[model samples]
Target: MTPITEVEGRRLALSNLDKVLYPATGTTKGEVLHYYAATAAGALLAHLRNRPVSFLRYPDGPDGQRFFTKNPPPGTPSWVRTTAVPHHEDKQARQVVVQDLASLMWAANLVVEFHTPQWQADAPGIADRMVFDLDPGAPATVVECCAVALWLRERLAADGLLAYGKTSGSKGLHLLVPLEPTPADRVSAYAKGLAVEAEQELAELVVRRMTRALRPGKVFVDFSQNAAAKTTATPYTLRARPEPTVSAPVTWAEIDECRAPGKLVFLAGDMGARLKRYGDLLGPLIDPDRAGRLPSAR
Candidate 1:
């Protein structure tokens, strides 16, 4: 049976609160909900505001069945706001917008372990940021990705674009640069160009090719995530891995020190303290005046 709780004057039905979502750590659904509600007023909610979010829900815990849910489930509270966004090019789907703490808590009740939000907010089909998902192939470690990320940072800085980095919370790192809301096509082109340049500079360490056969032991610079409707895990969201790891924002110095796997792992409980230290290093990316237009990647 589930228990009902009132959050922000709205009733929320929480189920399986005691169920262990992370088998290795024995983390419970209750802890997950508490983390979101606790972080809602700070770094987490600031990035989520007005963005259409897709949840990766694990109904039977992280080890069991999971599904990607974009639309709010049937019987969602009227107070839980949603925005109509295009899906599959045929029609529109209503995606939840985490506008308040209550809504954040509501999603946690559904056992959502991963928060994947579209790149664009408020303006659909237009992207406000360009992201490069640096995925390291097996036998290749996070250390290799860190080196490439540092290189990418230098390259972007030379071009006058600011880049921010965060762990993917699963097995890789993501580097993002804010851009003046440009057409998704243009954003994709700019990202691909940058990826190609990186590949040329570090031919052995980075691979622009997406073919699996060629990716072994190389860091894949995935520029394709810049497309419209494509989503990346939101910062501070927990991954449904064997352990309850979080997609944590990090400093360049920290990335340089990340010599091995599990060294940079951030659990849900560590988020508050991270907020205290980092104070949202990515916040300036969202500032209208701070984000600049993409320079020709040619």
Candidate 2:
């Protein structure tokens, strides 16, 4: 495979990716992986939206010592885990490779994800999982994400779109939808339209809608970055910053009640408990029935 990046001390291993690294959060013990995965989901999504499909690698934590890569490797961090998962299904890989992809979101406090050229896969199919990224210059939580999700769901359902919800493993709730026959581009256009519609409807509530808005605290609905050519960072991707950090996956239910920066939901302690009992809400997102847009791949 092609090398993603290189860093000190880290050796990229394509085999153990699944066992070691996750979407947003970086390498960790099997016990605490999910929490990081959830926390970093949003960041992963955002990152993908910005960049192309490439494996990202970095050290661990608020201050990691080295970086990692996503290829067969000339040299990568020894601690780097290569068993990463793509965000979506695709001709090359999954459409949305949700694992290690970016440094950190450009935003102050957001766990973004990555998007690939084929935002929607070509062959088979999956659900239309989406992340409603809200720019709350100030601090934000699950409540805000859910409130937005509810509004979006209501708005979407009105248009005959049935959607589901989940935590981005971080700051926002990803509201997935089930679209029939709509192409990925159409989905992107639809989402953008929805964002514009939301902005218009909630003009009073939204501090700003367009990228141009009040500095620092304006909440904007990012729909412009929905094109398949445009990519969002998948979860577990490393941040380009000095310290090796990845977005941690979070839960929608936990978002409203909890507001701890890296407080932890998955990898908090139990894996089976969370996986078995706390299923990933984004499941429907990749479902062809729900997240799948019509056969519109280029």
Candidate 3:
């Protein structure tokens, strides 16, 4: 494999391309780099544009030590666009924003298996979407989380909002509801209220508590992920798991199909085919004109 990949006139250094990352599938670092590069013009880049990314870098592969990287490391190129997002009222932090294929490939070279982005960006304080992270605890399967996601989708629809569902590419599902430009605080509060309501109606299936001990046998409606600086896996990201699975966007009809175990487990190589079929179900979220707002908390 070449040491430097010329992506759109940018000579990004790509090392150890032949090294295997996913031991189970024998997926090489080169394959991972190509996966993001090939998908850049479609779902991956569209969703990641302008968002500050927190990369889950696994330099020694998935089995080795791993850590989160927000700031650009020693060799980040000047051409890679970035912005200083507000971390707190008194402090700000610079974050990588992948606007081009070279930036995406550069991250891939670092073995950034997962891409997590803040809901709101520094250039725009207004939130892009409100997320309800549906995490299924022990004894509870992704199937249960799917049920809860469908329920949330129904309620959001009742309130004149459209909610999109996707596999977290991990152990659960994530329901993302796109919002017009709104205050981040208000978005967080609204998501919390929505989760509380879901828990109230479906007491058996949903739990809003953050306590891990109390989460057993139930899907936790994690509203806390909507806050500023908090990040969720970007759609089409490759997750670090035994199987080289990806965070995949799905349609309402496909959600039911996902209930079957492993049906929605999208692998890195399977991305292009899926994109050809679905064409980005979450694309509507980027539309600024989508009419959706949180009703006052009850």
Winner by TM-score:
1
Show where candidate 1 strays beyond 4 Å: 87-89, 114-118
Q: What's model 1's TM-score?
A: 0.95
lDDT of 3: 0.80
> Model 2, residue 9: displacement in angstroms?
26
- What's model 2's TM-score? 0.54
lDDT of 3 by residue, 188-211 (tens): 888888889999999999899989
Candidate 2's error at 87, in angstroms?
19
- Please, what is the TM-score per model? 0.95, 0.54, 0.94
Question: What lDDT is reached at residue 216 by model 1?
Answer: 89
Ranking by lDDT: 1, 3, 2
Clashes of each: 0, 103, 0
Cα deviation at 92, candidate 3, in Å, is 4.9
Per-residue lDDT of 175-254 in model 1, one digit per residue for the tens? 98888888888988878888999999999999998999989899999998888868888888888888878888989898
Can you tell me which runs of candidate 3 are displaced by over 4 Å? 89-92, 114-124
